[model samples]
Target: MTTQPPHASGANGAAIDLQHVTIAYHRRVVCDDISLSVAAGSFTVLVGANGCGKSTLLKAVAGTVPVAAGTVTVEGRPRRAWGRRELARRVGLLPQSNVAPEGILVRDLVARGRHPYRSALQRWSRADDSAVDEALAATGLTAVADEAVDRLSGGQRQRAWLAMLLAQRSEIMLLDEPTTYLDIAHQHELLELLGRLHAEGRTIVAVLHDLNQAARYASDVLVVAGGRVVAAGRPAEVLTAQVVEEAFGVRCRVGTDPVSGTPVFFTESVPGAGG
Candidate 1:
């Protein structure tokens, strides 16, 4: 595995901290004794096979899941302690599943992200309009800003959701499989946009299925298996062949990407394995 430079801590030191966190679902434990810290303004990716608690961990940090045994803190404040508006201003989450309003325009969908900033008496201020416009432009959705969400292609819909998150303008963003169903080109496009956002000082944590993409875009990677973190650090350090074999039970070769110098995995089918 090729090593990359260590990521610097965020300006606020740590953005999200999970201390001995445990999550259980329907009387069964999903994650146990999990501890992790994401520095502010850093891009961290979580990778693992399905059912490995990647989404659960993101939910835990987003205050959507009940922690069985630990604490989740955002910027030195317990997540549970923060009120709705306060929490919304500090962190934004893009869940794996979202329900788009029937016949809702893209601009309106993105505008929903600004709900936290709106009040009963004061609504739709210049700042909100600017945030919405900027988000639309940043995600390359300006041309179709007025189009209905259901009328867009899958990639465009995904970008619309990302634009919504961008509209939130939170310092930290938690995304669960942001590139779930897209072609290779769209996947790269989305990740490249996220990389640009990271460069602009947004703390981003995402659960990704593509290890190569995670290595290429993330400044740090956290690998979890069976609901516990098996490795955490630079992608090259954590995404070794041994770790891949152990966590995924597959034989693979690890190499460096010529273009990005990130670790890449080449899976080799073993003889006698079922097709």
Candidate 2:
């Protein structure tokens, strides 16, 4: 029932590359001496234990968090070489926090995505309008375009934020724990939409806590633990029982989902826990 996105891992080469990178928060190093690349048009998910620096890595690629050492290369140029607006045009970050200005209509909020394409002295153009329209349609927010963003349901509100990212028209999207607050069903719905977006050939790098969901949606998975990416590959390859235990500190049975044929994990009873 799902149409595959026009994607091939590494077919278009590296969209973002990090070499010997070190990421820190509050001047304390979290992840250091790391190297990796996000392939063009791939859905890459970072999965691991809480406080494993998954979000920090995603932010490093977005240039939100300062890289303490090494380099982040976007496309073929150094990340630092791009101007702020220029970087915004090629990559967009959707952080864990989703706060819209009070009473701001969805369309107005989405239009803000176009800010990168304009300067303070310039006016909004027809191109900006078209991008907003396209973003609205892509996220299926067209019907609620005029509704206030805060007035929408949790799921709808998330889509509104995603619409703004789409309007930015960045080839790469970095999402940090995008499913954090949604219920089970809504989480599935949002991930399904991300699948559709990937099919259209955008690169996605997200931090997700659910291994099953990550396996279901991600084209490439990075297992983070002990301040680094411990494993990276197709979900079937990297999400083994031992890997899960090592990264997440859980003893589990890993099996393929009956429907999606992706890896699924079920936790086992901890030793000496039940009395």
Best by lDDT: 1
The residue-by-residue lDDT of candidate 1 on 247-271, one tens digit each, is 7778899999999999999998554
lDDT of candidate 2 over 52-134, digit per residue (tens): 88888878878888988999888767889989999898889998887899999999999999988999899889989988998
Off by over 4 Å in 1: 1-12, 270-272
Best by TM-score: 1
Candidate 1's C-alpha lDDT? 0.87
Q: For every model shown, what is its TM-score relative to the native structure?
A: 0.93, 0.92
lDDT of 1 at 185: 92
- The local distance difference test score of model 2 is 0.86
The local distance difference test score of each candidate is: 0.87, 0.86
Q: Which pairs clash (backbone N, Cα, C closer than 3 Å) in model 1?
A: none
